[model samples]
Target chain A: MKLSCTIRKQQYQFSSVREVLGKASEEKSGDQMSQLSASSALERMAAKVVLSEMKLEDIYENPVIPYEKDEVTRIIYDDLNLTVYRDIQNWTVGELREYILSHTTGRPELSRISRGLTSEMISAVAKLMSSIDLVLASQKMRHQAYCNTVIGEPGRLAFRCQPNHPIDDPEGILASIKEGLSYGCGDAVIGINPNNDSVESVTRLLRMTHEFMQRWEIPTQNCVLAHITTQVQALRNGAPISLMFQSLAGSQRANEAFGVNKEILDEAMALMLRCGTASGPNVMYFETGQGSEVSLDSHEGVDMQTLESRTYGYCRHWKPFMVNNVSGFIGPETLYDGRQMIRADLEDLFMGKLHGLPMGIAPTYTNHMHADQNDQEIAGMLTALGGANFYMGVPGGDDVMLSYQDTSYHDDASLRELLGFRPLREFEKWLEKMGIMENGRLTERAGDLSIFD
Target chain B: MKQIDLDHLVQRVVEELSKKSQEAIPFPEEKELGVKNPHNREVLEQAMRRTPARIGIGRAGTRMKTTSYLQFRIDQAAAHDAVMKQIEPAWLAELGLPELYTRAKDMQEYLMNLDSGRFLSEESVRWLEQNGDKHKDVQIIISDGLSTSACEACIPDLLPSLLQGLALKNVSVAKPLFIHRGRVWVQDHVASIVRCKVVISLIGERPGLATAESLSAYMIYQPNESTVESDRTVISNIHRGGTPPIEAGAYLADLLADILRVQASGVAYAQLRVK
Candidate 1:
């Protein structure tokens, strides 16, 4: 019997740990005999006692929202002025922050409190405020403006008009951008795709978008640099598919079926470096998702390990131009929710809070089911906690359908849940316990407050 | 990132099914002939022939009719659900809808706040006009309700001119149409009923984050009788980042003559002879 079992084990191996756990669970629970089927009443009593002794507490604990959680949420809510934003007609940041913090009444632990307005949170708020203030101030200021238009007068020309970026007359595109900052437009954003277009067209469009912005005096937003990878099919017309999705499978095909042609990626990088040297803000947004076709097999290739290493390679290569801003760490929907924890663990291994280029998560729109919510929320929470500076999508890219309102509500809800709600009734408690006035200053006992406190 | 050749698989399965049919129909010649080099053109052509051309007329109650945005959303969701519910085993031969509908719904809910600045501007104009006795009706001119930011930033600066523009024309309107739906024709439709000297409709163009929420105005003079696309004038892309809303408004105020002269909308006024 032992010899036979060993031969059987050698013949087949379980695919994963979950499969083993599932088999073990089925074997342990498969006994059909009921407690009443015991030969004697005493045996049944023993069985009942064994079952009663099996504690369910092993799987769950009573939920508690600690004080620190409340405090942190209060701070963010107030700082963002989210409540006043929802109800009132325009509110100051300081005012909203004060209202929420003073009202919060709980003492959740610091860690328990959703890690409190992380650096990412702070930067997000700052960026939003900066944009808002700039817009408001510009409304009052004398500013020039431009629009992008396809024009045909003497010849076909693309005209862009913006505050500083104006391209009324263009002798040469590259030279116009080289003139720099004379035009009123703030900044120009140039985009380049290596795999999609050949070097010439890519260079032309990149140069044009940049030159137009330069003519308009727009400063410069980051240029999104891209590369195309193709895998050869041995059969038929020798067709090739883009490598953007091919990176999802790195291991099995690494030696044989798959190859990463650095020729394109390198050329794109070189052009970006040139652009970055001339201007700055060269960035790369990577695509990490399933390829265009559906397949039955689950294979790991171009895994997180390889991606992180390659990204770092690009970062090192472009250090002179500072071309960094890598976008994807976790691929989208290649795994089920049951498998996300493992995926996130892999992400941590590869994309841990490295400063040169921030990682952005491409969380799929399908993972918003209630069953999947916890996993999705955890993935987002981890990405934020892992020191990712900005998430490319808070909401919006839904199978590319462009359901605008749905994206907005999703952003609002995520903010509330991941961020937390401030206490609306804690103001009196704050005054009584802390003796702070409406302005958050000690009124009666202003002096001799404990430094430690 | 595993790339599976699904199109080939689909063709193979479909061809096998055709072989089993009672009529013994031959698979399209293009599909069968292309063993060495299966070009996409032939495949596409064969697929097109397999499916009959559908002519959808946009009449009310027909599939092509344009429903209100809300109605469109509900109907779309219902259709999606129905398809999922009745899915058959044979249909499993082909891949189905991408499993991201819920995520799309959730994310959509997150980023969009449609009513914030937009509905308010329209509603405010409606309320004031309803209460005021100065005119028999009101013209609630709003820009960029199509995109949230257009209204959020533009309406504050644009409102005064819009009001003044109406007053200068001696066009006292009742509570006017602050319809969220926008296109050149929408302005013509509203102008037909408002009966103002000219109906100035400020609507939002399509938006991107960088250029999104830019405002544009469409004006139609003596509008009625199924006015063509050439019945209005437009000043567009007005935002703090692009064209300051106030300046855009001021420019619109300056264009009253051009509007009256053209008696047209959009590119027609700029392009065609409008003497």
Candidate 2:
């Protein structure tokens, strides 16, 4: 019997680092000059970085463990990526290989590793002949390690220095740089709040920062420059402003005020538009004002309608050419009654439930010094209900500490908070609480429909 | 007048009708009904659970299981876009950004009113200027916690983190936007404003009987008008048995890197298909 040999070509091919390097070197030698021209300068830099970061020796030297994928593992993997939802424990080496081959779409460039797979498996997969690119690293530590392996110890650490802070001293900066460089710190950031800062101080600080980064051989792009402002100040200052409130009444009031303050707002917005183009920081947030001392009378003064109107009007008038992220703060009124806070009309108006925000930042908890367990839960639940991109205040407590131990403790607490909401576990708990049993068979009852249904 | 069979049948029918006429039928509205096929009902129930029936400023980042696949995809898309598009995440500082900007602007106007009557958050015509630049993007994730209560309690602390995280990320956040009344859609809308490729919302999914304050990540990629349910992904049920929050943050960064890798979001580039 004669077998057919098929030759296929495809677009968007993944080139190996070695191949790229060989071409680059040959170009330098005046040979293979035609092939070397395809890559742009940035692409070459990226290629060099990728090549230097990962070593073949490390990949092959890593251990591979024999493991079986279990039911729980399967679920986790499927949750991570829907493409591989079936049980793989029963598959033999041949079947596994075949499965991998089929899943790759014959690209020979990509690969997959399910969520629950062992680190050893990941290491093994990283060594495959076809696995020249696209390594799957699940954990943060793993990703960091991968970067380190490829980047080969950034010659110097990147740091953002704020002059006012005690830690921003030259000695402190040097020490921090030493620690990061020796320990493989990928990035360091510094925040400068201009309220209490001086231009002279900032200039000196920026110069020092720039010099330090340059001496350390860190790229300037790694150093980020930013300025922060608030909505009230933006409006008062001159920027077109929008208001975010807990109720519609506050929104309306703000809107009416916008009309009154149009001239001021336009001037402010126009200036902001100019600044935004140059600085690339143009976003606004409206938060319902809250008083630490909660009182119904004081809360009543916080009108939601007027606030919404103000926000709507501002957003409409300015046609804010670009918005980075928009959000509002939860007011004391929401805290008064948890049940009342989830009102449908209020959620729709506030969130634009029909439309989604790219960066929706909500609070998890506040008043850490005074909060109870119920309050914390409410914070976590609100995050889920609201649909946020990042949960910033996952673990907040104990008078706000800047020390390492405190931050670690807070991180642990936050992690614990997240674990409570695991999906399948929650699903199982719901089933058990309702006293309903499943036998793997689909059946229907002739009874009345459920409210949820 | 009829035959024996017809007479018997008529007698039986009359007896049944007389017996039933004395009892009153139960009303359908009053009866409590339970779901029989939970699997079939799960999609509907989950959707309902995620939706807010009435509008009110509830807790931020509460009752969201963002870690779930469905949720995280949605959250991430919005977050990436916020960064790429240059939109600032909301800040939870006292009175939030709007008030702060307004106060600062007012101070500027007060200084400028000697020459003119008005000033704004964008104008720098004051004796005292803001601590930072014009419009920086600060990506933040606030959770209402297990329910709406957590948001009310955690917003304060969340604000500090936003500042810290921004410092850590090395990018100045735009005037931090507060999402007082938040939901999944907030992320998408924010991304559009920010022009970032995606955004992740760290939220609290509804708690079960045993656990409260379970946090989640609702991620979205390229959040905009074209974004559908399929465009969103979730890393949910992030309480105890699920992925931890800090770990989630780290993992989230990795996903962000991945998002950067393919430049495609949601289901499109989340996974690497091996052949």
Candidate 3:
């Protein structure tokens, strides 16, 4: 394989495929923290050149982590459509990028090609594309899933109304849910990140959210973002659960750190199928971030972006209802600043879409990171333009319980209006009935939680 | 006067001026409803009272009202400042904590490099080898993880309560050490040096717009090569607004006692308790 590239009079050499992939990645603090990134800009460009020339078969042959050692690599390899892989075996990464961006290549072609591509190839092509390239390619693919409501329809966006409270206060969570609903958010899921992860607490929140959904007849799903074990326990105790939630990483070690494995996820999916309140199939919701593997010391040697792509590969095995990417949630050690955060969000949206998943972008930022509300808003708008299926709608863009800023209720409404998109068909009708939204715009009666009363 | 004394005097004057300026223009209370006449004003007020979320604040079109917007920005600014600010040396002295340093040369290095904040500096390691209490039942560490404001606000109250609680439990604790620019994993290093059965680090959490004063306690028992993140038990959201510092300290003492009795921590401890 070509491991060296000469750009303008400088020669750059990477020792291995993993090094080339890591070096070719867009600059983020996580890779630099792990000391795996390119040492200089010229070297990065060189790595990209080398990566672009490499064929898909090369990446397929050299998994970042050996398949024998890592279950994540095994899952990704074992799930490959070998017939499709043989068809695209000789295509270079550069050719793959051009083919993906070609006008001839729409969702049908892209979806077919996606079966042959590995996560490394996805990461490779993404590294070679500019921000606009990412946005344009992302806009071409829109994957849909169904649970309580259908997500990722054309000309529609959805939001997970994340109404979290510090102490798992039921009334506080309910109040935020009403506020979110008033603004035409929560069509994706009315999810809460509970402070208490006990089975009893999880069950109580599930019961409360389920009861609220029943009372108002909201056209959305409900979830408690607790540990999967706790949620499983809650389900066993006969709690009402619409969607099961878990945070997944790219590596087996990281998933183990999260107290989850393929068996556990498989069991959860089976249980949700049997006992979950949501409609047929697509009952799992997953949250992924770029830096989790690095922070947990589980990335091995792969770059953050590649690890993120691998996470998508693992996530697709479950056929999740929603795959929310929160690349900036880990703080400065991973993303560094607003620019890096925005780049990560764009890459994740495009990659997740290409992997045939219902993807949402949580263009989020912690106060400690050098990103502000403006940066987050820009990311939200750009990803929305990139055809993200949904975003997290926190009250006022501030998640008091999680202590980060994401797309807010106002941002959720604005994205729909800006894109000339309405809510999910069912949700829009429900909004019209509530007199909060009309003609794809929020009315004067909107943003007032008292309307629910 | 000495140069340090002059610097302190200047800081004091600046602080006083800021206080006076804050008093001059009294900001509207948080309790004031920002929404214009709602369909049901009483219910909106009650809803706003329930969660710290910015609800019931009527939007001007698809954006927040000016007051609500500024309030959010101001809180975000405070949280950013909290992350960047340094804890005062005099405050650490007052708390009687011997200071230790991590390998990070500055805040940028500390934030960007995980390993820089995870290990002690050469001088700090030497100091620990010389002066650290050895073979104690427990070791206490306090760090400005991401928010120094959290340490400044919560430690004064939390430390004393924790000490008292430990005393009541008859648990022998080493003299608590303060490490600058430290992360949670640094506690494992301190534990290795002190040879404690268990180590607890009260570190500042990543600041939120709601409050930059939140702290978290991470307790690990005999951290070794096999220890993963799940090996350490954590209690977070310790602050005036969340779990009050005093209450958190007492609860942490009880938790530490339980861990010691079980001879485990984190997931292992939880599983053992279930059994």
Candidate 4:
């Protein structure tokens, strides 16, 4: 197919589909760090023009990383529905973008088409969409998954109450959990990132959270975001685990760096199904970001955005209950500033939804990056408007242990009010019974942790 | 009314306003609970005492109350400023530290480009070759990493105690040098030049809303091309709020002595100790 285009009398030639995809992507510091981004604004536009004319079959035939060498590529190809692929193989990337945004393309048609598209194809079309384009297209597709409580149902939003502690103090963690619950923020899960990753520490934190949930009769899940192996040992030791957590990368080498493999994940999922506290099918919670592969030095030659999509492809294998995309978590070296962070958030939300996963946006920023609370709020609002399934609820938007900022309990409550949404069905009832939430709004008795006393 | 009387009245109002402004209410302390009329205030206060996470801050209709909102902003602003601010040159000179620089030309380059902060400049390399103390048992490096405020706050107290601890142990320590806009990996380069067995880098951490003066020490034993992240041992959150600088200094010295004895650092050291 054509791989060259002339814009403003400047002919730009791309040698491969990988080159075109990288250059056509929006400006990102990670891609620039790898020296894969387009050199100039005009050249970027030229690459996008060339990519728009390329057919779906062209990208399908040429994966960025070859299928034989990469497990992520193999998993994506192995899981594709070839029947659906053959029907739309000849459509141009430009046509695919329009079809996704068309008024008639509802959730059913989008879901059917999603099974055919590879992760590369999803990344390709996302490069052509603007901020609003990503949001509008993302709004049409909402994928639901179930654990103890249902996630991603229409007109319902959820929050993972991330009550992290710096020293793995159980009493401190329980206190934060109480505070989050009073704000009606713990519908998705009460996931804690422990400073200590030992099996004993993970098991202790899990037991504490599980006991607290039971004591309050709260309709939620409890998770300790230690390494998957550590969680497995904890589970074997009889700790109550509601959701299994792991940080995923797009490539095999990067996954290796993270000390995870497909085999390990498979065994973990089987264990969760057999003995975990959560009910059925979706028991995994994954956190993915764009620059992880590059930072780990495992992104062979692919762009950050494309690698992130491949991560989603690998993630959907477990049928995760929550896929939290934390694009700006690394630093300015990856996202550069608020604009880039916001862009990555929108793109990740849309891509995860297109992959038929229950997606959440963390919309996080570190202190070193040139981002503040305003930029994070903008991302949270835009993704919430785009029908994101869930978000993280840190206390006052600060994670003391992780040393980053995420959506806070106040932001979580405000998102529901802004979108006229409610928490999960069971959680809303619990909040009403406790006099914390009514008519999808927090009541007068909310925002006081002592109410639990 | 007469114009003169009106002018006098306006002057008196301005003076009264200035006096009232000068009597400004002190900003609310972070420890003071923000929740109003809790069901059990004692329980809320006890919970607030447990963790530094911002809880018990009552909300205004699904938003932070005005005082709490401003407090969060002020803390965030301090963190941002810490990353952007530079360590004072006069202070570095006062410590008798020979200054070096990374390849980064400015703060923007250092923040955005990882490689720029990973290696020394040509001038710095030559300066080290000419003047650096070589073949020592340990070489210490101080860098103003993400937060220069951290270095400015902790080094004066931390450095003296660390040197005293090392001297008491009779460790052959090289003169410490300060590197501007450098990351943890720069210590490897310094080690390669000075030919030290153990190299330690006391660098600033990315400022969090809790404290901007936090620092971290990354120690590596005989860094080579094969050295991975696990080869380096890190002791983080060295600040007044977390681990006090003076205490971290003595602790690091003792840890260095252990590393020298075991011939390892990081995971290897931990494993060997267990064995």
Quick one: best DockQ, which candidate? 3
A1-453, model 1: which lDDT tens digit per residue? 000111223332333221211121111000111111233334333322222222212101110111243222222233333332234222232232222233241223211211222212211111122222322321121111111110111111111111111111122222222211111111212222221122233333444555554454333332323222211111011211111111212122221222233354455445443333233233223333322111111122112222222233223222221221222221122222324332422232222222122233333323211113334445444433332322322111111111111111122123323433111122213333433222322233211112102
DockQ comparison, 1 vs 4, better candidate: 4
User: Better model by TM-score, 2 or 3?
Assistant: 3
What is residue A294's positional error in candidate 2, in angstroms? Answer: 11
Q: Over 4 Å off in model 3, which ranges? A: B1-32
User: DockQ: which is higher, 2 or 3?
Assistant: 3
TM-score of each: 0.28, 0.24, 0.94, 0.91
Give the per-residue lDDT digits (tens) of candidate 4, residues B215-251: 8999999999767655777777788766689998998
Clashing pairs in 4: none
Worst 10 residues of 3 chain A by lDDT: A194-203
**What pairs collide in candidate 3?**
none
DockQ metric for all predictions:
0.01, 0.02, 0.57, 0.51
Q: What digit string (tens of lDDT, one per residue) describes model 4 on residues A173-291?
A: 88898899999899999999876666788888998889888988899899999878779888988999989999999998888767678898999999999989997579999999999
Angstrom error of the Cα, residue B113, model 2: value is 34
* Pairwise lDDT winner, candidates 1 and 4: 4
